[model samples]
Structures are given as C-alpha cells and as structure tokens.
Target chain A: MITPGAALSKSAPLLACIGLLCAWQVASLALQTESFPTALEAIRAVPSILGDKESLVNIGASIRRMAIGLSLAVLFAIPLGLLMGRIKGVASFFNPLLMIIYPVPKAALMPIIMLWMGVGDMSKTLVIFLGVSLPIIYHSFQGGKAVEEKMLWSGAAMGLSAPQRMLRIVLPAALPEILTGCRTGLVLALITMVTSEMIARQSGAGNILFNALDMAQYDTVFAMIIIIGAMGILFDAAFEKLRGWLVRWSKPQHDMPLSFS
Target chain B: MKVVSLRSDVQAEPAALPGVAPAMAMIHIDHVSQRFQTSGRQSHLALSDINLTIEDGAFVSILGPSGCGKSTLLYIVGGFVQPSDGAAKVKGKVITGPGPDRGPVFQEFALFPWKNVLGNVMYGLRQQGVKKTDAEAKSRKLLEMVGLKGYENFYPKELSGGMKQRVAIARTLAYNPAVLLMDEPFGALDAHTRTRLQNDLLTIWERDRKTVLFVTHSVEEAVFLSDKVVVMTRSPGSIKVVVDIDLPRPRKRAELLLDPRYQKYVVDIEKLIDDTGEDEIHA
Candidate 1:
C-alpha cells in the first residue's frame, strides 16, 4: 500500500543521514589525520565492537539496569499519581515538594547517593530511578486529574463503586496522558542510564564510550555513538508501537508517519 | 391494541385508571436553591426557591435560556450537585448522592472513549452486579432500542454526534433506572439528528414509561416531548410557568408539527421566557 510519495517520505530521513555521513567522510579525507577517524574506519569498527564479549556484556548490563529502574519507577509512579490526583488535599500538600524537586538535577544527588549506598550497582540504579520516576509520576498525576468530572459522575450514577470507577473510567481516561509521560520517562531513563554509568559504574554503553575516549580510539567512539543513536531510535519506536497497541481502542486506526530519533 | 380491562370491583374505591394510578411522586424538588461562591468574594445564586414534583412515569421538561439554572436544577435532582437550601427526594427519600435508580445523560455525550458502544452500555449493568451474559444481552437490547445494534464494537470516536448521544442514552437506560435526567442531551447535535432523536426518544419513552426530567433551552423540544414544560426565568432562576401539553397520545413528529396546539404551546413558552423583569420570589 506504500505509494511512491510514501516511499520517498520514508527514505527521506535515511537519505539525509547518508548525506551527513558522506560529508563526514569528505571532511575526514580532507583532514587526512589518524586522530580523525573516517566514516569507513567507524563502519569497520562496528563488527569488532559487536564481536567483543565485553561490549555485549556492557550492553546487557545497561539493558538490565534500565529494565529494573524503569519497572520500579512505573510501579511507584502510577499509585502515587492516582493518590495525588484523586485527593485534593494530598495534591496540594505534595505539589510544593514535587515542584521543588522535579527541576533539581537528579545527577547532583549522585555523590550523596554514592556516599550512602557505596559505589555499587544499587547506587547507579537509584540515580536512574530518581531521574525517571518524577516525570512519570507527574504526568500520571496530571492525566488522572484531567479526567472530566462528568465522566466520573456518569460512572457513579451507573452505581459504580469507588474501585470500579477508578479502574473502568478514571484509568482509561488517563491512559493517553500516562503513556505520553512514559514516553518522556523512557528518554530520561536512557539519559540517566548513560550518565550514571559514566559517573558511577564501570559497565554499560557509557563505560564503553568513556573507555574509547580514554584510549584515544576515535573510530571506536564514533562506532559507539552510532550504536547509541540506533538504540535510542529503536527504543523510541518500540515504545510508540506499544503505546499504539495499548491505546488502539482510543485512537483512530490509521498508519502514522514515522519520526527519526 | 389489546386493552386489558381492570376489575374496578377489586378495590373499595378505584383510585384511578391502571395507567394513571395515583402514582407516587418519584422525584421531588422541595424549595431547592443553589449558590456559587466565586473567588472574587461574590456569591452567585444559580437557582432560587425551586419547588417541583415529578410523578412516577411522567415526562417533564425544564425549559429555559442558557444559564437559567435548568441544568443546575437537573443536576440537583440527579444528586450530582448539592443544593444550598432545601433538597430533592426520590420515592420520599432525599437524594444525597448519585445512584443507579436515577440515570443522567449529559449534553456532551459523555461516552467513555476507550469503551466501544456495547461496552459503554454494559457499564452500569456491570456495576450493578449483573452477570456478564445477562449484562451483554440487556445491553444489546438497549443498543437496539437506541438504533445502534450494529455499532456495538465501534468506538466513540468513530461514531457520529447523534450516534454517540444514542450510545449515552443506551448506557443510561441499561441500568433500568426509575428516572432519567437529561441535561440538554440533544443540544450539541444537528437539527436533523436532534429531531430524529426526539422522535426516537418519544418512542422509547412510550414503550418504557420511565420518568424523564429533561432540561433544554429549545421550547420546541420541550413542547414536543414533555407532558408538562416548566419554564424558568433568567438569573436567580425560578419556574416562571408550567404549561401542560394536552396533545393526544401516541404522538408523531409530523403530526405534532401539523397541529396548531403545539405551535400555541411554543408561542406561550416563548412569551413566558421573554418576560424576564418580573418580581423575584424568595423562599
């Protein structure tokens, strides 16, 4: 069903990316320096990076950390958001705390977290959790609060109990907003993952990038950058697909244009 | 039509006809007044000294202009909003909160977006502890009654404005409530759809005989549907007049339009609504 125009639109971003790579190649040729790794050199380094068991281990470790931290964040955020959203008094009490803490760089807490939890994986995971949890929680709170009062009244008039109303009406109404929050949280989780690895841990994609820098392996660093970019794009696409599936009942069933990461 | 004759000798004194038994009032609004306190330190009185009694199986319409507290009165009757003074009662019991006995349909067609047509209709029955099979069967029947039998799986977004409103009505009726409170339910629909729905509603009301308290700004709608239209005035809203429509039973839309009586009722209602500077009544 892909028309010529649709095909062209799909390939447009890829074409632009190739053009950027060509420019990089041209610049690398002009420089003709060993320190400046050419596009070909970075492409050749990809297999070696993939072949290295240590690199695979690092990727695995990073994925595991993300999974654990994000899962914890999801668990904590949903209920807290629901609580804060449904109860006005609770929302008012916590609003000031959330506003104050949300903007503060979660990474700044790294040193204190490290001091308390030691230089363990727990500290790194905690940092990532703290960084990712707030956005999800805040978004859920906003989403939950955004449910129309009329909808709630309709449910109540139908003789829905408190729990049934929350589950059947409130939750579905808030799904779109909560999913948007999760999308934002996913990006933040990745950023936090890299940052935590760079500052605290000796494993993950961040560690590989850091080590490449230290060894002056510019081609390997460029290769890792490409891998990271691909990973971010892949995660975003996956989450978007998940969101579409979860909210298919709410949205129109039409193919949407894909966005480059 | 098969008319079953009642045995008048069964009782010492026949109270009334079988259909017009001395039916108890299902919903009673007793001197209910509501006020809103704004942030500007001024209190706005929405409804002032409103008292009305809706008998069981009666179709009453509260006709007024926008912001005339017709909707406020409907909400108070439905127990969604508390009255500042006095109260509303259902079956001699004061309404403190929303319950399945009184179903309300909002003007905005508040169907849950996530739920399809069938799901929305089944919502109330499910909450009432109806078994899944029974609920589905009843919901399907209700949907068919609302002319949405084939659109059970269609989401709210996919439905036309009129279809969505139908789904809302079906959802409310699924609970088998004693009374239905509608707040400008067709106001958002187009003229054609609104008229079609009005006809559909009259048909359903005739079949079900459920009490309905409909609030609307359209005098035509009030005249066409309601047995009695309680016209209210502007700000500090109170019932200005209650015009009884004695049009013949089993009414049809075309017939009502052709009838001069309907036009006269509309004209009188318009005059009453237009007369705004009358002395206010304080309870």
Candidate 2:
C-alpha cells in the first residue's frame, strides 16, 4: 500500500534503482574480480551499445516482435478465456488440451518451431505468443466466471443481446482481472523473448550478451545485461502504470506485483 | 374496506390460465414453478404455482424471508431466469427473454463498475438505439430525479451504497421500461438511506406510475411502498397471502409511520410471515 506521502511513493522506484547500483558498485570493488565489472564501468559501456546502429536495430526488432506477439495473444486469449469461463462445455473441451500444454516451456518450443517454420521471426514470435497466452487466458477465465449474475440480468433487462452482454458487460466487468493477466503476460513476454533468443543464437539483446562473453569483452557483457535489465524494469513500470489507470475502478486488491516471473 | 382475501386454495387456475387473460394487466406471472437441481440429482422446489397479476401503474412487493425465491420470482419476470414451469408475461405477450419493456434494479445495484454514473445511466438508452445527445439529456434528467445530479462523473465504486442504488434506479428508468422489476433494490442500504430512497422512489413513481414488482424481506417497507404485498414462505416457496394495502396514494413516510392503519397492516403481514416457520429458520 502507498503511504500518505504521494511524492515519496512516486520516487520510491528511482531511489530503489540508485540504491541497487550503489550496492552493486560496493560489492564488485570488494570482490575485486576481473570478469565482474563495477556498476559504473557497465554504465559507461551502455552508451556504446545504444550508439551502435546495428545493436539499436536489433533491439528495435526484438521490441517490435514482442509488441506484436503480446497484442496477438491478448486479442486471441481474452475472448477464448471468457468463453471458457462462462460456458461449461467450452471449458471442458479446452481444459484437457490446455493442461497438457501448460507444463511445457514455451521458449523450449523454439528449436522445434524453428525446424517447422524456419529460423524466421515466426518461430520467435510464436514462442512469445505461447508464453503470454496462458496467463491472459487463465485470468480472463477467472474474471468471466466471477462476474455477478445480477449484472448480466440487468444487462439483459436493458435489451442487451447475449453477444452484447458478453461485450459491454462481461468484457468491462472482467477488465481488472484481464489487465492483471496482461501485466503477467508482459513480464513473461520479456522473459520468453530473451530466453528464446539465447537458445536460438538470434540477433537480439540476448545474442549480444553471449557474443560479448565469448570474446571476453566483460564490460560489453555486463552492459548488455544492464540494458536488458533496464528494458525489463522500464517495460514493467510503464505496463504497471497503464494497468493501474485501466483498473482504477477496481478495489486495488494486491499492492504488490504477483507477476509470472 | 379489505377487497382482497386469503383464499383457501393454494394452487390457482392452471388450465387455460396462460393464454385466456385478455386482461389489462401490465405484468402477469401464471403458475410459475422454479425447481433447482441441488447436488446429486436432488431437485429442490424454489417457487410453486406463483400466479401474480400486476396491473398497470401499480406498486407491488413480494415479501418473504431469504431463500424463499422472492428474488427468483423477480428474475423470472425480468426474464433473466426461465421458470421450470410457466411463463411471465408483460402486457399480454409471453416474456421469452429480457426486453426494454421490463427493467430490473437488483439488490447489489449491479451498476457497471467501469462506467461513471452518467455512462451507466446512458447504457440502456444507447442500447435502445437512442441518439447519443438525446440519451445524455435523458440520462442527466434521470440522474437528477434520482437525487445524484453532480455525481454523474464518479464511478459506482466511488459512491456510497445508497448512491449506487440510486444510480441503478436512474439507469433502469432511463430506458423508460413500463414495468420496473426491483429485486430488493433498497435491501442493501442502511435504515436511514433505505427510508430516504423509499420516499424518493415514490416521488419518482408518482410521475409515471410504472408497474413495479419490488421484492423484499421487510414487512414495513412492503407495507409502506406497495399497493399490494404478497407474503411468501420458504421450503417450497409459495404465496401465503396477498394483502391489499388500500392506503391513500402519494404516501408520506412520516405520517404513515404514526398511522394506526399502517401499523396494523405491518403487524398483520409480519404475523403472516412469522407463522410460516421461516422467521426462525432465516433469522
């Protein structure tokens, strides 16, 4: 829960970031390891990574794919999830198949998917899509199932047809929960993106980290790690902000992030 | 001056009752029986042969204990639930499903949490294909009538329980439904808010006098607001008695609270309910 001081709550994240870096700087200096660069050294190398046009393009492509994958999953999953939640027959039909697929690592499907779809963006995007879809579907399902019966009845009385009720009533009513799923899915999307790129040795931020490590460019390695870490933090923060606004109507049940990560 | 009586027969005319009524009734529920499959093939009867005729521009309340299926009866009329046996008709036609002709205000308020008060009120009008400007104008008027004028931009969650119910009533009224099916609309509020809303409801109802089917457990509330009170019992819920209020119109709560006739009606209805063995069971 946020305290009474609005300023303190707003600046809490920035303060935490600085505090983490100060700790990292102190620990690296004390350990005195060659491979483990100090926080400042990695910070200095960050410019070179961003300044390089190829690196920027690679990271940009990674983001574009991530955005597309997340959007597609959200579009597909929410409706399916709501249907599953509301209808017993639909739920039963899909439950067994989902159960079988849920346990398998979505990123691990990269190698097999690459074999089938070739080493294109399709395989990578598909993996990310798979990674995020489950959480969104699960959350939307729960949200739809928990909608008040009387709300639908009110909608019915207002001359809303079955489909209209699902859209106007169920969709908005389940939005808070659905947004929670999307937030979790966003975190999963980033994770799956990096992990899949690492496995496939693709041209992404993940590939840059490994390539730098192989060449013994410790600063670049740490710098790449910092960039990816920053991306994750920035993306998560931005998403959390949007989620908060979208679900401002909801009684903020959990102040802490119950992320899939 | 008691025109209505408690007849000995529990079941009303079933044969030819569904269709023969060329009656001027606004809403007619004939021989409606609702049975629920309560776990492992055990079917529990919720409502049994509830034949109710609500005339146009009349205020009727179904008074019963919790789980007596009073709300269920309201839902049947609202066309949200299909009765296991029989049909609810609104103005001579069978209620196949919910329509704009019968609007419902639920106990939970059931206001869209996402939408602000204005948006919620405008929903029915928009659904009915009214132009946006016209819907907005009508919704604003309805909001003012419900006594939540400046609070239109606030979401349902931001409002008090009373305010939320007011918004719900406004939302339902915006559609201009001939029959207002209120299923314990004021039951969730405190006594003070309840009385305030009851007074406000009568003021609003007086203007148009829409046929309202209000369901509640409060005897005083039923007696105060209703033209006729249908006292019901649980465990095979059925209408135990239908008491005609016969009170003068435009009823004022302050005067009615002190009136001997009003007190007697409340007492008589309470006794009827107490005799059903539900007071102990539910309370």
* Per-model lDDT: 0.84, 0.86
Worst 10-residue lDDT window for candidate 2 chain B reads B1-10
RMSD of each: 6.3, 5.2
What does chain B score (TM) in every candidate?
0.90, 0.90
Give chain A TM for each model in order. Answer: 0.91, 0.92
Model 2, residue pairs in steric clash: none
Counted clashes in each candidate structure: 0, 0
TM-score of 1: 0.92
Off by over 4 Å in 2: A1-12, A258-261, B1-23, B280-283
- Model 2, B1-283: lDDT tens digits are 1112233233332222122243257877777889999989899999988878777777888988898999999888887888898777788777778888989898899989999999999999998899999999999998898888899899888999999999999999999999998988887898899989999999898778788999988888898988888889897989988888877767898899999999999888888887887654221
What TM-score goes with each of the models? 0.92, 0.92
Chain B only: TM-score of model 1: 0.90
Q: What's model 1's lDDT at B83?
A: 86
Distance from true location, Cα of A203 in model 2, Å = 0.7
Question: What shift in Å separates residue B271 of candidate 2 from its native position after superposition?
Answer: 1.3
